[model samples]
Target: MQGNFWPDHIRRLIEQIGMEHPIIQAPMAGGPSTAELVASVSNSGALGFLGVGYLTPEQIDLEIRKVKELTNRPFGVNLFVPEISEAAKPSDKVLNCLQEFSNELGIDPPQMPGPPKYSFEDQLSVIIDHKVPVFSFTFGIPDKALIRDLIERDVFVIGTATCVEEGVLLEEAGCSAIVAQGSEAGGHRGTFGSTEGTPMIGGLALVPQLVDKVEIPVIASGGIMDGRGIAASVALGASTVQMGTAFLCCEEAGVPGPWLDSLLSSKDISTVLTRAFSGKYARGIKNRFIDEMSLLEDEIPNYPLQNSLTRSLRNASKDKGDSDFMSLWAGQGAAMSRKLTAQELVDALVSETYQVLKSIGTNL
Candidate 1:
């Protein structure tokens, strides 16, 4: 066992989450994170995550049940904190523009989904009712009562932060740990309260700074693709590492073929942070839809609205086997992604980190 080899902090985090390794297969929501992938990674002794950000409460339960059926080991579920802020207000002009976009995609213009919106509160209740062992969230801080309830149930809670202050708030809100997500991270930017505060700090620079500022454990995220990255993060004071982009190419990832192909052929610096797809800043591959939407950036609605508006286009693109009009979310380190099964990837990560650490330790 590598028990004695782990640094004190990493060991503590591993014990905190009850994982055998300090690696966490990031919850790559919106389809890539499959139940099989989550189970395989957890079964490999690393924490697996189910990205429930886009799922309905019923869907969330079904996904959790599927993962439980596959593995008796501990795993986690990731959600987005619902933020009803004054970021963007709906306008008639915006609706017309969206209608035009719908016309271009040969789809019906969207109508308000109405009162019973997909409730985060509902999802949280499902997670609790099922006694989910680990829960994590991003976008904004979860309410205190929910945090307390999860703690009472012994759920190890994690929150995502794009900067030190965000991390501090999460720790203050009683998160078990904070995932310091740098600009290079894929999917949505987890910036909250102070959006400009942590616009785009790179992983190497962001992790250590947060570690210095916060008392809780910090997990490094963004552009991390291999064991070298993990070993480097530990040296930089990250207790563990959360990775998303690297796992997109794994066999069990529910990614479409065109999307997977782009990641497999991607190079460093190929991704950009854009809000054209989901109304919130997220890192993804540059594509036709992104380029076209860039011209209309100012009119983009707030996250929930914009995300709902474009859902059909992205979904249709996937069905048509086209990448040009799809949201190809990926991190900057996509070039380092390997085509392997989830278990193979986890094992490789562990072995590679062990070797890197061992070599460094010997030299020291």
Candidate 2:
């Protein structure tokens, strides 16, 4: 029965990506998606992806080892492909804007460090050496040679696309699959071309468009909460469904208590996409910081620069369990989120998908 509507296509995708189900857990960085969470998702017959951003290669290695021990099934690792901020030395403008917001939160903003310094090469090497089964990336595409290495090693390479152009680029770069990230998606927007003002497209529209435009499989992400959403994605021609907020409510998510509470209480309008947190624009719960900071965008530094400046404030908020200051990343379907175990959540999603398909005569 599982193989009927889902069919050999999904099973083949699972075999290609080394998973049992078509569900891929969106890799959310900043301590939300953990190895335990990934392993749980993997062990439960779904693809689990660990967000390996903002960490050193050694730190990533440690997490890989931990997940490997916890689950014998195949798991995935998500990385933030490095991108250069368009602003040349926009630190002064960013610092001034950050100071005002820091004052509101009653915290001191850190001084401008020179430029962003993270070893993408080293991280790539670690992923290759460890031979992670599925490697998904966001922000931007890596060089062609790096893509070749992953392909040569038979790693399933997934790239993010905010627009059809980005999807085309990923196809050209040899990505095995594409995650069509809609405007409602949490975390950073994967708008690659423009450094500023990328047009926002909803998943309902973006998924089918990308599917028609690209040859590779398209995974629907953003605002996907339950089985109906999963079936809708499949009906729209998506091969898989990737969700973040759905899992954030799971026991394995390990987010702060206050953050979880906020997500639970949130309505559809509760989330917003703001560059206030990381200067790269991520969709999260609209809080005091995002509202006030959005008023002063001109002063915000570009991505890693603004990202570094607010690290302390975000950390403090996380430690103190203050949802107001923390970047509570979540999709618009947050209200539909249920507090369940990872395995339970996966089961629910699968069940819901079957029912939706049955209702639509796709599962017959």
Candidate 3:
């Protein structure tokens, strides 16, 4: 119930982020992670995150200011590390598949997206200019120089890792902490390292491994939806836990109606890993888009390209209140999701964590 009860690493992280709880609301980019959601979670004594992966530098500045307005508590900003080269292009099959989806959604045919309006450096400038208390990144480790600058400015940097190798790479790259994102996590996979295939290690196995290999704290993520999951993460040596799907249906979350409804009704087997939505493996509830795209998994272009090609179609689906084409991102624990206000949810999680830990201590 108190910071003193937690391990030194956990306590240190909480203090470093100015949060009362060692919990972080996973930044769900594109939507779901709204300014209101971020602020509300931070106000609830846990760290919240603004997912600025898809936002321009200007938009990122505005969102950070908005969160500052809503909560004095420290929060974090998450970015997607740019990995795609300028010469990378989508294959014709990828474009034609998107075109078919566009026709079905009555949207214009897909086109190859131009380079980003701003570079990752531009985005980092906004984060540094604002002196954001916490910054996290996924997809890959950023350049050491940029990370050093952030650390020099006292910005607590967290990097996401799907495997121990990536975790070590992040530690060497100067990350203050690492988020051990399990395969069960929703949204985009944080895997950027070379692998035989996508790393499918679950949190129960991944957390302790990363903790053993890395000296810095490891934040367990993926399929962690409740206090029980949080306790399990701690037991496995994670300093804290990062949860996303658990908060997907929260009142302050910016989830679309159809996507929200899908999550509310999701079952244990409801989710599947697919690259259809973003060309990066992400777990989400099965829907028509994922089902149809499963056949073209090999043909789908890599991220940013595939993500851009389907942006209009996904938007059209959302606007039409259709879950078929919209990316219904949710973790495996979605069946346990509860619809509550951000404050109420955090309170519940803290209370439950206390109770669970107490019971475990007594039993041990």
**TM-score of candidate 2 to 2 decimals:** 0.94
How would you encode candidate 3's per-residue C-alpha lDDT over 12-87 as one tens digit per residue?
A: 8888789999899998889789999999999999999999999999999999999999999999999999985555
Against the reference, the lDDT scores of all candidates come to 0.86, 0.85, 0.90
- Give all TM-scores, in the order shown: 0.95, 0.94, 0.97
TM-score between model 1 and native: 0.95
Q: Model 2 over residues 141-199: C-alpha lDDT tens digits?
A: 99989898899999999999998888999999999999999888877898886444675
What are the RMSDs of all candidates, in order?
Answer: 1.9, 2.0, 1.5
User: Residue 3 CA error for candidate 3 (Å)?
Assistant: 3.1
Candidate 3, residue 338: lDDT = 97
Best by lDDT: 3
Clashing pairs in 3: none
* Candidate that scores best on TM-score: 3
Worst 10 residues of 2 by lDDT: 1-10
Residue pairs with colliding backbones in model 1 are none
* Model 2: per-residue Cα lDDT at residue 221: 93
